[model samples]
Target chain A: MPRSAHRRPAAGRLRGARGLAGWLFVLPALAFYAVFVLRPIALTLQYSLYDWDGIGPSTWVGAANYGKVFTDPDLFDSLVNAFKLIVFFSAIPVVLGLAIAATIRRIAASRLALVARTVLFLPQVIPLVAAGIAWSWLLASTGVINQLLSLVGLGGVTRAWLGDFATALPAVGMIGAWVLLGLCTLLLLAGMSKIDPALYEAARLDGAGPWREFVSITVPSLRQEIAVCVTVTVIAALASFDIIYIATQGGPGNTTMVPGLQIFYLAFSEREVGTASALAVVLMVLVIACALPIQWFAKDGNK
Target chain B: MARRVRPGRSGAALVIAMGTLAAACAAPGSNSPQPQATGTSAVSKAPACGSAPITMNGYFETGFPLPKALTTEFTKQHPNVTWNVREDQFAVITQNAPRVLADNPPDLMRLPQVSELVKDNLLKNLDGYATAFGWDKWPASQLEQLRLGPGGRPRGEGSLYALGLNMSMTGVFYNKKLAAQIGMTTPPATLAELDEVLAKAKNAGITPIVQFNGGATGGLAFPLQSLMAAYGPTGPINDWIFQKPGATIDTPSNQQAVQHLEKWIKAGYFQKDVNAVDYATMMSRFIDGQGLIMFNGDWESGNLDKQMPGNVGFTLMPPAQQGGKRAAMSAPLAFGIAANAKNADCAAFFLNWVATDKRAREIGVEIGGSRPMGPADAYMPEVAADKVTASTLEAGADIAKDNGAMDFIANATGAIYAKSWTPNLQKLVAGKQTAQGLLTAVQADYARQLEGN
Candidate 1:
């Protein structure tokens, strides 16, 4: 018994010694997260409650700020914009990604599939703001896009695409879609690669056709990945700001005034710290509102 | 082998961590944009002509090609001067004033007004330089404006920090050809005259004014300031914005200004979505010649000249209640030295040349692009001709004999105009509320800035 008791400490030490290197390996990452991510999040939550300009002392304001957000028109307009983005990024692109992945996977050369995936994903590599700016010039009032339309004699259709209230929302949302397609295509392609060749062979042996096999085998296998992609894409769509802020600046009236730009206008232009914070909190709440259900599905898919 | 990337229940946790880290690191303002450090070879603080070619640094929004073209002309006259012109957003130069002064400051900046630049004491006193250089060539009105405070500060008594080289008038720019097409003999000379023109234009199916209620650029502030000036004198708006001289909100001019806009709105004097437009889009509409009037600065003349192909015209916007000294916002955009300039004297010499001599006229004609303050018929023949177009250049009288022509930046300059003014007007035009609500919000914003500052 004494020997066994003595062995306990030694055994524990040996086990700990084995894991010690692993713990050390992770410490840098954890420290990085604690410093940048976790700390900033905590600070954001703290600051979101206070009325402070970037300079000078902060004043404490309670839920009164968030309470006011429920009534802000700009907040609601931005939410609608966020919702409008889902059609382009989360719904349509993911389905298209799935199809492209399936088609590319059937190709004999693995390298070609990889190349195709990389090429398809090139848009994601382009800086989104730069892409948005390029698009802005093309879509300007007297730009090439309008010129081309004039060429086709559809001059009436070629209004200032970014400036018009009618088209600004969709035009901005399309940029969000453009940003995500590359990652989606790559991820969906990766998932297709992971589908065991044996399962596909079994489906073929069972006399299943291509569509049947894809639906029965590939679809079930990718459910988890699909869930993940949806969650991520939805989060991304909700968080879209760079494109709108850079291109239109929430113009043609408040038509382009998405929630993100509203936050900026509030903080900078309106200089209402309380209102801006409230709007930010509302944005956070919205992100969570959109994300939580998908998060549940992701968790369930994990199980 | 590197394990495939996964999340949460990840075997390759480091990969996931790195991915997150990369994304987080790549996010907004990750490195936090720092000002580009302009290089400097230190020169004497005291004003003396340098053996090294004086590097005169100036910042303007556009017409960069003009300045580049004038380099040869300037070098011919003063072989020892070279313009190291750094072009960026004017706002960037303003925002970085403290840092620019502390570190390597630009030698000269094309400032909008002396007030904002002078208050911080960033200007070099130009009194001695002007006196020595015999800058008697400047107009009497502009000469009065050149007198700086004790130390070339922007204050009336401040030193002459810089000369007023080029001036852009802010009044009504109307299409005379379009008005003639619509059977109107002349552009509006008064608010009532404007009303009649607006109605006739509306009947003719042209939007009266291209209003960008969304931003502070001449869209909303021009009209709002005009209304305020028209209502009473320009003194109240001045008292509130610059002097803090106890101007009450509830004045007849204030009400009159609000009523004037309301009348215009009821009569459909503006575009359908005036709140929705920006300055660029407004220009597009005006260039298309759909609108009868555009209330912008003198700079728009060059723009209209470039953008509008044929039969375009210009006119100064009439005063709100034009009877007294025809008050318009007479803002003469000027230049100043950085607080900690590496070569203060070189900068001043450059300043003196641009502000005092034939170079002043030449650079004004070339660089300012809108209106040249130097003797007429120099280089920019475009700006020198046409009295209607020239009205904006003429608006910068040293004194406000009446309230109608109060200088927007100096006398009645309101901080709210930069931030709240356009947005408030937009909101009002969007049918959010009355101008009263907008004005109240502006007053509230002023109070906040005052208290917070």
Candidate 2:
């Protein structure tokens, strides 16, 4: 007991030194967070309670801006539009990713396989703005897509896909799908590579077909990767700006107006900074609300 | 290089293009003037930038050419003074204005739009400088257009907040070869005649209009405003645009103008999938000789002169009735001194020189592709070097002489174009809505904005 008591001070000093070093290491990141992240968020929160025209001195409007976010039909419509994108950005990509990953797992490791894998992952490396521009050109009325269609004797179906009210939102969503599909497939394929080859062999001995093995082994093993893809794609769907801004700009009669674009227009063009900030806050809350359940499913689905 | 479909605006290349685009939403004035409110006059010489190690900060868009010339002259006059200029996208400047004005601001700012800046008191009132420089000698109509009431409310009768280096005019730009093919030997004398020309061009299997509505709606609004000015009573149109008391945009004449646009769209005069085509594509295709006519402002005159010199001709949209007033849309590329400008005097000095100096006026016309607002005799002969410039100047002179100039309707509110007009116009063109429906929607937005003010 006497020896332990004597050793306690020395141990306490060592522990204190380690604690100080840990804080020292984290101080730079903490400072950055306070200034760049927390500070801006704090300022935005304050601005959300006002009726400022961005340039003019702000008038205190309390919770009026927040109230508007809830009551304005356009804001609600914008939120709904953002959610609709998740079908294209998250659900379809993850499903198609699984299928592609399963199919690629069976292919021999030849040069053709390498080339296919590289092509599948290519979209992830390109800048999103460039991708959007490419897509816009492809989808334009007289663009290459229509030229191809006309060549195949399907010219009657050709239309301005991005500019038509009926197709604009879906057209834009499909661009998101095309961009995200590559990422999802690559991630799932990486996960599939990590699965034990012995498991598939054992399943085959149990009279399991390829589909059964895939459903039982591949799907269950990729639970975490699927979650990650879903979370990332969902956030992207909600917070998308560059692609939409460059491609459609929430136009063709506001059929594609998402919260992110709406916030940009309100803050910059309309000078309604207060409302823009309010919408931003609402969007943040929505992303969290939408993401939490998907994360939960990813974490618990295998069990 | 052809224009690009820039996310916000085409920026520097479209500086003059956007200049006219916002003129509608940025009505210089709407309210009745306060009786006997006139700036006092005092003739003054060029401001001296005293020899000191001074750095004047400035912000401008790409196409504005005055900064280099002004800086060079200023530095030459005062060797110790230097200009530090920052060129940015128009959208960036506009979006960052409030924060920029509140924080560290430049000495000079090419204001995106006036009403909001004036309301926010982000600009230094230029009346004192106007009085000091004997600017009262300038035409009252030109100066009055710069005035705005307190908080930027009721434009046109308060204090001057900005100064324009030069003005721009909106009109029809025709492909001369296409026009000849369509039997339009001369410019149409009236809107009805122009309609006939469009039909003839369509019958000839040539696209009559080359328009781009994907990125911005200003392309659509140009012809719409011209049509309104041609058929509608000038007073109500101007008053509605300026946001005058009891003004309303849902007038019968405005409805008729919308219907005419609808008719044009229905007659297949415009390109198929115009809403999908971007500004750059439209200009490139037009340069490629794909269209007979395009409604645009003179800001593109320089580009037209450079790209397809002899192939294009310019003319203002004619009035609906023969011998009726031939009104056109015209406005200036305006700049204002920041309220917190460190070198307010230096900025004011530049504005003074740009407005009153003959050398500056010559530069404004000959090189800048700008239309002159002063006397006809004041125009530079050097402008004749560019055919587009010569024709635009001629049209400007006619409009100025007859007082047939009007501001853009969108200038009534900053949100009018993006929030209201753009979507409605797209819907109208798509055949999903009526002309009256479009006007009603736009009027509601305008009223809602006014209520907020």
Candidate 3:
């Protein structure tokens, strides 16, 4: 007992030294995070309470900017548009990704599968801005899309997809879907690889069809992956800026005005730093509100 | 359990660090000096470049080749002076100006909208440099747009805060071949004549006007503003743009102008897919003879001349009536020195040299395709009569002679262009907005922004 008690003190000392070394190793990253992320967040919170133009003296107008975020129709409408984007940015990608992943799983050993995987994932590799520009050209009134439509005798319905009031937002959302589909598919495919073949074989022995096996085993196994995809894509939809900025720029009569672009216009274009900061805070809260539920639901599903 | 404990500990640490940072740094703009009106006499005389080498830092708009050519020439002329220049898109410059002026304070920067920067005390008062270099002796209209009254109100009537690199004017550029096809020899001198030309061009199956209305550029505003000038006096328009008290763009005359523009839109004078066309596309379509005319500025003259030499013609927007005075959106390519610029003297010297030097004036004409701002009788660069640039320059002179120059309405506020005018114009193109609604909405937005400021 005396030897054991003596050893415990040495072990405690050793643990203390290791902890200090570990902290030292991570100190640089911690400092960077504090400066870049934490500091900016704190500053944004502080700035949200003021009426400042980013330059000039600021006035303390506590919560007025936040009030504007909710009360202003333009601002509120932007939030709604962001929510609408989730269907394309999150839901469509996830469903389509699952289907693609399931199909690829059957032909996983073939060379064509490799090519399919690479082709499907190409959108994920392109920069968002380049993707935006390319998509904008393809969607223009006289662009390749219209050319193809005309060839197929669909020319009468052809219009400027990005410049139309009814189609601008959906067109932008479709671009989002295209960019995220690749990422979601690759994630789901990776999840599908880990599923036990035995489970599928057992389903087959039970007279289950391909659809039933997919629904019963593959989906249950991918709960966490789907949740991850939902969380990431939902965040992308809510915080989307680059593609919208390069493509529509919240134009065609503000039909595609998302909160991300709205905040940029407020702070940078309008010089309304206070309102921009307030909108940013609200967006962050909304993202957290969205992501936390998915995470909790995923954890519950796991149990 | 250990991992959970670590995250909690880290969260507390982050809070502590953030609190420390919040305390360490003062609120942004808290320490900034309250903007006070500086007297004209408070400016200091610009010193000559001495033997010591000076490397002036400049922030310029990207894609404009004139600034680069000018800087290179300046360096060659004065071996002791060199340039370290950075370039960005104009929109990016508008966003970055405040920070750049506050932190880095470039010696020279392309000032797109100077009123806000001036009100923030980020721009240097150039009255003394103007006096020293006799810029005051130049045409009053030349420096009018660059001046701002106290607190940046009534922009054309106070201390000079910036100088023009060159004077740029916007007008109608027509495809000569297309115009001939429509049997138009001389440029239209009246609105009725212009309509006749447009209808003739349309009947001949040529696009009348190729004005872009896509994305963020809103090239439609160019024609809209020109129409505004055609139907009314420019005083109220300029007043509204300069944020003059009681000024409104929703005046009766301007409404008439908008109605005229709507008539053109309804008459199919523009391309069917005009809303989808961007500035580049519009320019390309115009160059390819897809359109008979394009509402653009002299900035395209140099390029257009090179692309379709002797195939394009420039003219002012015709007046509402025969022989009536005409106006154009004529403004300077304004550049200013930062309030805290280290090489203010050298920057001022370079600006002066750009205007007065013979080689500089020639470069300004050949490359910039804009009139160099100097004394009314200053040496003017001669160009071939057939070049599109010459016609544009001649139009600029006519604008100056009539004292009919006005600022682009897009420069009224930093956000007005993108947030208000652009969307409203897009809505107009989409048939979702009316002319009256467009003006009212824009005025309301302008008033709200002014109130916020």
Candidate 4:
């Protein structure tokens, strides 16, 4: 009885030592996360409660900066624009990714399929800033798109796609779609490869056509991947800065302004650090509010 | 299960520890005035740099070769002095200036907007250096824009905080070949005559004026400000820009200027894709002979001399009526010393050399493509009469005679250019906004920014 009791304490000590070792192993990563991520978030929250020009005196103006974020037309309009971008950045890419993944599955053994995947994924390899610049050139009034339209006897419709008010937002959205489509397609393709072939065979035996098999077997099986794509792309659309900054800089009368760019201008250009921090905090909440639902839906689907 | 719970407890402890560290690092209110550094009086009165080797740190605007060229020449002439320079785009400099000036303050920095910095006590007051170096003897208008009154309100009236490397003036640059093709033998002398030339160029199927309205740089503001100078006296405009009490940009004369710019837009004189063209693309298109005229500053004089040679001509934007007093957007390429600079004497000496030295003045003309700001009798560099630089220099004299120099509207506030003017001008080009709406929107934004300040 004494031996067993002594052994119990020894085992407990062993377990405690193991725990300490595990924590030691994670210390570096934890330190980085604390310094880079958590600290900035906490600082942002603190800054949101004050009025600062980043260098001069700061005044406590609790909630006034947040009030401006909701009441200011420019700030509010940027949020609306980001939400609208989700249609192009998230919806179109996801839908197209499903279609492309299905088609690639049919030709999985062919060499053409390899080339197709590579070509479609090419945009993902290019830097977003470079892609934006190349796209701007292609969309300019005297660019290849207009030249092609002229050649097709549709010259009357040629205008600067990125410089027109009605078209600028859609144009920027299309660029986002172009950049994100490749990522989505590859992710969904990977998920499709993991789906049980028996499920597809069963659907086929039920007299289901290619479309029915895809609807009944493929999509249901790839819910997790679709959820991931929506979450990532929605975040990308919301946090977008580099592409829009390079292409339009929130111009053509602020048609393409997003919260990310607006926050940048408020902080750096306007020197309104408190308002910028407030907007940043709001953006973080928005991202979380959007991501949580998708994550829950994906997790709930597993049950 | 016990192990997992232990990690969770440790994670919570780690977060608490991090929160405390961040709270400790959070800065307290920084409004308390710093102690004034002494020994500046002695340095300001020094006639020449000491023989000891000195490294002057500088921050300059990228894409402008003049600053770099001048620095290199200064180092060569004064063998004891060297430089460590950093360059960034003008927009980036504007965004980074406050932080850069406060921490890691460069000995000399390109200051695009000075009032806010002076208000924050980030810039060294140059009044003592001005008196010591006899800068007060120079043309009053030359140093006018560099001075700021109390509280940094009403610029042009108080202690000087910066000095110009050279005087820069904005005017209309025309393609001589395109002008002749449009039946123009000389530069236009009146607003009506300019309109006739623009109409003629349009009828001849040439882009009349290729102004950039794209992205962030909004080149449209150039012609818009020029038009403002043409339609009205420059005093009220300066008053508005200098932030005089009760000053407003919504004045009737300025409204007339906006209307005139709108008329030009409606005439399709600009390229259909003007709003899509960036600054670099506009310069390239103009250099390729795609446009008859472009509104630009004298800083491009040397560049045009190399690329298009004698095929280009420059003239001040003509007045509203024949023989009316002309005005132009004229300001210095201003540089200032940081409040915490370690080498104030060396920097002041360099500024004086850039103005008074004969070789330095030549570099200012031949390299900077702008007139050096010095005494009224300072040495003038010789350029061939037919060179574009010569015409720009002559226009400088005309602007001086008219006492019609004005600062760029973009410099009115640090954020006004990016937040208000660029967007409004882009809307104007897109046909989504009216002239009056543009003015009103900009004025409202200006008021809001000032209130925040």
Top-lDDT structure, candidate number:
3
Instruction: Please give the range of 10 consecutive residues that has the lowest summed lDDT in model 1 chain B.
Output: B29-38
User: lDDT of model 3 at residue A101?
Assistant: 90
Tell me the TM-score of each prediction against the true structure. 0.69, 0.90, 0.96, 0.96
Give the residue spans of candidate 3 off by over 4 A: A1-13, B1-16, B33-37, B40-46
Model 3, range A1-303, lDDT digits (tens) per residue?
Answer: 123333555866655555555666677888788888887888899889899888888888999999999999999999999999999999999999999999988899999889989998999999999999999999998889999999999989898899898999999999999999989999999999899899989999999999999999999999999999999999999999999998988887899999999999899878999999999999999999999999999999977
Candidate 4: residue B175 lDDT (0-100) = 98
**Number of the candidate with higher lDDT, 2 or 4:** 4
Best by DockQ: 4
The C-alpha interface RMSD of every prediction is: 8.7, 15.8, 2.4, 2.5
Find the 10 residues in a row with the least total lDDT in model 2 chain B: B26-35
Per-residue lDDT of model 1, residues B1-453, tens digit only:
233323433435555455554543322222322322222323233566557766666554454354454445667776887777766655444444434543556766665444434433555555555555454455434444444443222233334556654554566777767788678776566777878888888888888787675423326667766666655666555445443435555466686787678778778787755654667778778877778887777655555656663445555456555544455665456666765565667655655555445655555653454455443333434444454334444443322223233456323222345445544565566566586676677666556554543
Q: Give the better candidate number (2 or 3) by TM-score.
A: 3
Give the alpha carbon lDDT tens digit for every residue of A1-303 in model 1. Answer: 123333555765544454444555676887688668765554555556666543224567767567666664546767787778788768867888888888988883878877887788888888878988887777766779889999999987876676555676777777777677778877877887788899989989999999998899987888878877888898777777788777766654456666777776666544455567667767778789878887787678667
Which window of 10 residues has the lowest lDDT sum in candidate 1 chain A? Answer: A1-10
Cα lDDT, model 4, residue B46? 62
Models sorted by lDDT, best on top: 3, 4, 2, 1
lDDT per residue (tens digit) for residues B85-143 in model 3: 99999888988998899889999999878888888899988888898889999999889
Stretches of model 2 off by over 4 angstroms after superposition: A1-9, B1-46, B51-53, B66-81, B216-218, B373-379
